[model samples]
Target: MVSSDHIGPNETGRIRATVKTDGKKGRILKTVQVETNDPVRPLVVLKLRANVIDAFHEKPLQPDAIFRSPCRKCHLDRGRDQMGAALFRADCIMCHMRGKSAPSISSLKKLSRERLKEAIEEGVPDSMMPGFSWRVGGPLTEAQIRSLLKYIKGR
Candidate 1:
């Protein structure tokens, strides 16, 4: 909708319009036409294009990157293992939700710490899980991996 169809040059020579979109994902194209008093150029047209998508509230990390470098800056606190908890929430919760593909905390508690660390660092072969170490093309550093482990083990 245009604020006004007619605009005077002395007042405020501006063209303003607004568009509203629904909860649908798609491409949109619109052309707006304006008429002028000039004889040489009597009309002007503007085109607008937009792409809409429905996505998660928080964007996931890149497939090849475990975590973003910027996010690591603020996650330096080691007290209470908050960094580990944050990492798990950001990375693991997707596939390891309760009663989902991954086992529960109670089930994982039976495994030895070394075994759990091995699985997390190396990932199981032919599985969807990916190793989160930079040496293996993952986003986590050694310390971050340890933090994640501590968080998972509730230590």
Candidate 2:
């Protein structure tokens, strides 16, 4: 849904927003999409249930889709444009801090799942690494973090 302003014909970025349906019972869902302009990004026409009732339906385009969420850094971007890559990129702190000797997680060059998980839980001290398990203001939820790990593992 990244619209014309944030996403031109060729800007690589991310889309994250929520969709919800209101009724006797409703649910809110968060969605994320990453894309490079190689092929015009496909419009995602998500058909969703508007309420807890299976019969209810609602389809809302993500705000980030309407307004592209530009990634802060593009130099480090490899093919990790996917959400899995974004999760792995979280480890860039430790990878680049160690410099040549440290593994380059920023490159999206796959890493052992366990290693990446460890990096998330117990960051490399004295380096840019920071533990998400108890970060005072970091955004990832435990479930979200696990989902990202599982997704990367599958990849």
Candidate 3:
């Protein structure tokens, strides 16, 4: 998206762009090309770079904040009545997918079933990974946790 299609002589224009940081992290780079009438520089390329932080990157002062308000919309609601890959896509992928702060799906596949189950139920110590089991104040139920475990291990 651009601010304007044309710029008058001796005038300046703006180029605007938006990147969806959801399910992504680390350094991100993108490029945009603009065509101009200037003979000396008919085309200009703009480089956009950003460092995405995890949605839960904030201090542990409010670990359960994700289960409330605006965060709940994406973190909780999306996983309602969902199971297996669908559930992971809705709830887990945002942070656990590639390039994000948490472990990627491929990496998770390497863990034993018991380890994965414990992580999901009890969360990891001193890490951003939060417990998704109801006993730990998370939104997932026993059945859901089982489903997630099965899905993750199968992958």
Candidate 4:
């Protein structure tokens, strides 16, 4: 929430937010979008990061855990009906974007198409990357995977 809806020139205001960490662990990133009237930059994105430690502490969560319960509310349900770039932004970008645990788009673009496909379909072994294919206990369907592949490749 913002301290005020309006801020005069040369004035400052506070933007505060809260996050629920109940079933979440490890590094989590959340974004807040602020809309301004400035002609130069109308919208600003603020990133909030927190290392949520519950009983798990610093242990890595099972990749598939994101597909369950509370985590799925943000990670899975948001992208359920999305495809292509929209899907990436909703489901993948939070972790895969710059300065996160997952590989950024620049690095991912370097992989061969076949290798990238395999990575998305089968996921990296014993890593935080989970296979997105529904056949592998993930939420993505064959068509969604194909759409994501095309979107990533085109990036």
Candidate 5:
């Protein structure tokens, strides 16, 4: 459904779409044709891709649930006090707990700046810590990763 059929000059448009697979699996691709009255371009195509998995569904994670993991509860309040702190709290704090399977961020003090940067950018092998650098399909930028490193080292 489209919010408005007609779009005015310099105005934005909103569209709400729903696709039902109905128990089908595998990759599904669909293209939506948006008809417009502009002289230069009359139609726009929007491609949407969805992957349907048959098993092992995953739950979405919420940033506000900062204390979902037991270890996060320990530094619950203190963890929210830095630039990268929010980033870390949103992405890392869950798996990288102090006494859990993943080593705590506090232990990163032993690593050199270059090594730490590589670990975040390239990720650890055979480990749960995924790379956060966009170069490797991760979400974090160099500056944001550096900020996280600085936050980890208490600097």
Candidate 6:
């Protein structure tokens, strides 16, 4: 796919590249990246049309990809539900827990809801437990913090 900026359709001063993957038949379908220059009004159109860094080029994620967050391994990926799931899988709690692993969603099932929320606030320091960045810290949003809690609890 291509992103057209103020470069006015097919123009010059742009960058272009092609990506392809091997197919079972030995042939492959390639993804293309063609950028036209229009410094006058370029305005970051690379991502507006296609993210050049994406290897799959809009292809459905592989199973492993589904297990992690696409945006940031350190931050939320999609909706709260998906983001939380990614956090849980990534063992985000261990960021400060040191040698301990993040509580499994199954194990969290045994904890009381009140306790869970409390733990979220007071992270298991030395482990990967990242206190809800939005709660008492800076940066992370409320939704992300909430998602981390929800993900920890396997909700």
Best prediction by lDDT = 4
lDDT of 3 by residue, 90-132 (tens): 9898878797878999999899999999999888888867788
lDDT of 4 at 34: 88
Any runs in candidate 1 off by more than 4 Å, and if so which?
Answer: 1-82
Give the per-residue lDDT digits (tens) of candidate 2, residues 13-56: 54445564322344644445444443666544343334366332
List model 6 lDDT by residue over 36-101, tens digit each: 354675444342222234343256433223224442433333233545666455534422234444
**Candidate 6 TM-score, true structure as reference:** 0.34
Model 3: residues >4 Å from true position, as ranges? 1-61
Better of 3 and 5 by TM-score: 3
> What are the Cα lDDT values of the candidates?
0.62, 0.46, 0.84, 0.84, 0.68, 0.47
List the candidates' TM-scores in order.
0.47, 0.31, 0.63, 0.64, 0.46, 0.34
| Candidate 5 C-alpha lDDT tens digits along 46-127 | 8888998844214433332333453244434344433497877766765676866677777776788888889888787766
Q: Backbone clashes per model, in order?
A: 1, 3, 0, 0, 0, 12
Q: Write down the RMSD of candidate 1 (Cα, Å).
A: 12.3
lDDT of 4: 0.84
**lDDT (C-alpha) at residue 11 in model 5:** 87
Where does candidate 4 stray beyond 4 Å? Answer: 1-58
Residue-by-residue lDDT tens digits, candidate 1, 37-92: 86888998977778867442147544333233453322222222335777776566
What is residue 35's positional error in candidate 4, in angstroms? 14
- Model 5 scores a TM of 0.46
Evaluated against the true structure, the overall lDDT of model 5 is 0.68
lDDT of 1: 0.62
